[model samples]
Target: MSSGSGVQPKVGFIGLGIMGQHMAGHTLAAGHELHVYNRTRSKAKTLVERGAVLHDNPGAVAAASDIVITMVGYPADVEAVYFEAGGILDKARPGSVLIDMTTSSPALAERIAEAASERGVTALDAPVSGGDVGAREAKLAIMVGGDGMAFEQASPVLRTMGANIAHMGAAGAGQHTKMANQIAIASTMLAVAESITYARRAGLDPDVVLDVIGTGAASSFLLNGLGRKMIREDFAPGFFVHHFVKDMTIALEEAARMGLDLPGLELARSLYDRLVSDGFGEEGTQALYRVYNAIHA
Candidate 1:
C-alpha cells in the first residue's frame, strides 16, 4: 500500500530485539497499524501500549497483517519463524508481502523466496546495516533482494526504517550484499582496533589520534563510530560480537563455496571466537579492542 495513498497497510513485525524494536516503532509512527510479536513478551510492552497489536507468535502476526517483516537473529530463527509448521508462510495471506530483514544465509533467502512464491506470497530478503543507532534514528541502509515490483511496493514501508534502500537483483542478492558488507567490516574492524592500540602504545592520546585521522582519507563509519566506542570502552551491543561472528562465519562459508580465500575475514572470525570463548560474546563488535588489549597486556 502506498504511504501517500492514505491507505496505511497493516504491518506485522517479529523480533523485537535492539534494532527491531526501534524499527517497528518507526513503522507504527509512520501511521501503519503494527502487529508485533517477540519471544520475550515484555519487550513488546511499549509498542502494545502505543497501539501496536500484540500477537502470540509469528504466525498470528502474519495471519493478521498485510506485510510481515522479520528482523530476528540467526538463520535458524529465521527458518523456524518462516518455515515451521505454524510459521509465517503457513499463515500469511496469498497477496501479503514477506520481508526477512535478518542477516542470514543466501541459500535460506532463496529457499524462502521459492516457498513464498509457491504459496502466492511475495518475499524479499532485505537485510539491514547501521546498527542500533541507525535503527533508533530510522536511518538504516537496507539492501533488498527480490522482484523489482515487490521492492517498489515495499519502499514506502522500508523508508520508515532506512535512509538508503536499494533493490539489489533477485532472491538472495540482498544477503549476498550483506555478506560483502560483513567481509569489508571484518577487516576494517581489525584495522580500527589495531590503530587504537598502536596509538596508545606510542603514548599519543588515542582519542586525539582518532580526531585527526577521522578527518582524513582513513576516515570511515567504523573508524569514527566504533573507533570512538573502543576508546571509551563502551562495549554495549550496537551490534553484538556474537552476531558479527555469525556473519563472518557465513561470509567465510560462502567464500569457501566459491573457491575464494579471505584471510582477513578468517582472522576476524578467529579473534571474535576468542572473545566468545572469553565470555565477551554478548558485547558489542567494538569489544574486538579487548582482544588487542589483552594480547598487549
Candidate 2:
C-alpha cells in the first residue's frame, strides 16, 4: 500500500468518535487527503478545521475516496453506512475497497463481502483490539479478514492507525478472531478486578499485590492497565463497559449458534450486564471494581 511518486492515497473515514477522531487524524497527519463523515456533524468539525474534508453523508465520503474505512459502533450501523439507501456502495467507484474496522458480527462481515463483491468492490472485516490508547499511539492490533490484494491495498492506511496488522484468512475471519479475543479477555478482566478487590479487603496494599501478581503467570494488558486504574479509582472509559458488554453479547450469540458452551465468557457477560444494569454502563470497564465495592462496602 505504499505510495507511488507524489500521489498519496485518497482516504475516507467515517465514525468520528473517540477512537475514530484519533485515527482519522493520523491519516490526515500522514499527508493523505482524508474525506471524513460522522453522524453528528460537530464531531467532524475539528478534523475539517485541520484541513480534512467533511462530507454531509457516508455516500459523499465514499464517492470522493479510493479507500473507504468505517469504524462505527454496531453491526447495524456498519451495514447502514455501507449498504443503506444512499450508503457508501451507492456512490463508491467499482474498484474502491471498503474496510470495516468495527468489532462486529462475522455474519455481517460475510454479508458485506458478498454484497460488495457483486458490485466489483472489495470489502474486508478488519476489527481491532487495543482501546483508545492504542488508537492514539498507533499501536493497535488489527486483525484483517479479506484476500491478500485488498489487504495489501489497505495496509498503508491501516498501518497509520495500528501496529499489529494480521490478515486472518478470508472475509469474516478477522471478526471471528476479534470475538475470540474479547471472549478470552472477558473473564480475565473479571478475575483481575476481583483479585485486586480481594487484596484490598484483606488490608494488603493493592499496589504491592499488583506488583507481585502482575509479575507472575496472571499478568495481562487487562491486569496492568485495569489494575492501575482501579488503584487510582480512575474509572474513565478507554473502552466503555457498555461496549465490552456489547462485544460479549455478540460472542455469546455466536457461541450459542455453534452449539458451543462458553461458561467463562457467559460469566463475564453476566458481570458486565450487572454492571450496566447497575447504572455503571457509561463508565470504563475497569469500574468492574464497583462490583466488589458493592459487596465489600
Candidate 3:
C-alpha cells in the first residue's frame, strides 16, 4: 500500500504498552493506514476507537501492513511476536521492513536481523529512549541500526515519534546504543540516590540540594527527577526497577562476551538485585532511593 507521499506505507504496530501506543498513534496521525496488534486485545480497543484498525493477531497485523514496528517488553517477547507459530515475519512481505524498538540485547537483535535477512525482509534494530513521557509526547530518542536504505525509509515515520534520531551503524547497533543508555541510566540512578541520602543525613534540605546541584555539573535526569521523588518518599515507577535490573544483566552479559568488565554497571545491578530481594522489584527505578534510605535509617 502507498502512503500519502505516493508511497503510502501501510504500517503495522505490535505492542500497545506504555510506549507503543503513542508511537503507533503518530503513524495514524500522519495519514498512514495503521494496523495494530497486541497480546491483550483490550489495549487496542482505544486505538481502534481512534480510527486505527486493530488486528486479532500478529500475523494479521503483518499481512495488512508494509512496515511493521515492534516495541514489546524483552528479547523473548520479540522472538515470540516475530518467530512464533503465528509470528509477524511469517506474514510480512519479502521487501517489508521490520524494526524492533524494544531495548533488547544487541545479540538478540543481530540474530533477529539475520533471520529476517534470510527471508528477504529488511530488519532494523531501533531501540528507543526518552522513557514513557517521551513516548506520550512524541519526543523519543531513537537509535537505529540496519540497512541504510531501510533506515532512510523509516526515518520520517520514526521522526514523528522521536525528537532525536541517529543511524548507529549496521544491524544491532541500536540495541548496543540502548545498552549504553541503560548502563548510564542505571549508574546515574544509584549515584543520585546515594548523594541525596547523604545530603538528608547531613541535615540539609534535600530539595534545596537538588535545586542547587541539579543546575551544576552534577545534574542528570536521575539527579533532577529521582531526587525530587526521593525527598517526597515516592516509590512510584517511572521505569520499573525490574526492567532496569534486567537491562543491567543483559549489559553485563554482553560485557563478559566481549571479555570486559562494566564495574559501575555491575555495582548498580547489585543494588537493584538487593532492591528486588527486599520486594521492591515492582517499584519505580526511583525506588533505588530506598536503598539509601535504609542505609541512613
List per-prediction Cα lDDT, in the order shown. 0.94, 0.89, 0.85
The TM-score values for the models, in the order shown, are 0.97, 0.96, 0.94
- Which 10 residues in a row give candidate 2 its minimum summed lDDT? 1-10
Best by TM-score: 1
Taking the tens digit of each residue's C-alpha lDDT, what string does model 2 give over 1-297?
224555787999999887899999999999999999998999998899999999899999998888899999888798799888888888877788899999999999998988888988899999889999999999999999987898998898899999999999899999999999998889888898889888988999998888998988988888988888988888888888888888999999999999999999998888889989888888888888888787322
Arranged by TM-score with the best first, the candidates are 1, 2, 3
Off by over 4 Å in 2: 1-6, 295-297
lDDT of 2: 0.89
Per-residue lDDT of candidate 3, residues 151-258 (tens digit): 888887898899999999998899888888998898888788889889988999989989899999998877887779888888876567888888888889888998
Ranking by lDDT: 1, 2, 3
Worst 10-residue lDDT window for candidate 3 reads: 1-10
Off by over 4 Å in 3: 4-7, 295-297
lDDT of 1 at 52: 98
